[model samples]
Target: MSNDDGSMKELVEFVAKALVDEVDRIEISEITGNQTNIIELKVAKEDIGKVIGRQGRTADAIRTILNCAAAKLNRRYILQIIDE
Candidate 1:
């Protein structure tokens, strides 16, 4: 992974941690590909709705920020929110 990857991961992690009641239960995994990157966000089961928000708007906002950042780096990003 490059420095940009690290920063992007940190960005997702930072945002996810802030949305969860159990910050310690939050986990993010990055799967790097040739053309696109997949960021998997996992938070406590009880906090899933909070992260996903009403009508998934919160998740969409996070994804929007990620895509904007990825565009500057000439990359593509995909966010997947999961319960853990």
Candidate 2:
């Protein structure tokens, strides 16, 4: 992965860790493709609600930020919040 790719991963990790109570339980995986990147975020089952927030607004906000950042890098980022 390129430095920009790693930075995007870290960006998701940092935000996810802050929202979930179990910071250590948060896991982020990145799948880089030619045109788009997928960021899979897993958090503790109990903390899933916290990360998602009501009406999914929180998640949407995170995606919005990610989209803006990815645009600057000329990439597309898809954030998938996985509960496990």
Q: Clash totals for all models, in order?
A: 0, 0
lDDT of 1 by residue, 15-84 (tens): 9888888999988899999999999988999999999999999999999999999999999999999997
* lDDT for each candidate structure: 0.92, 0.92
Estimated TM-score for each candidate: 0.96, 0.96
Check candidate 1 and list the clashing pairs: none
Q: What is the C-alpha RMSD of each candidate to the true structure, in Å?
A: 0.6, 0.6
Model 1, stretches more than 4 Å misplaced? none
Error of 1 at 56 (Å): 0.5
The residue pairs in collision within model 2 are none
For the record, the alpha-carbon RMSD of candidate 1 to the native fold, in angstroms, is 0.6
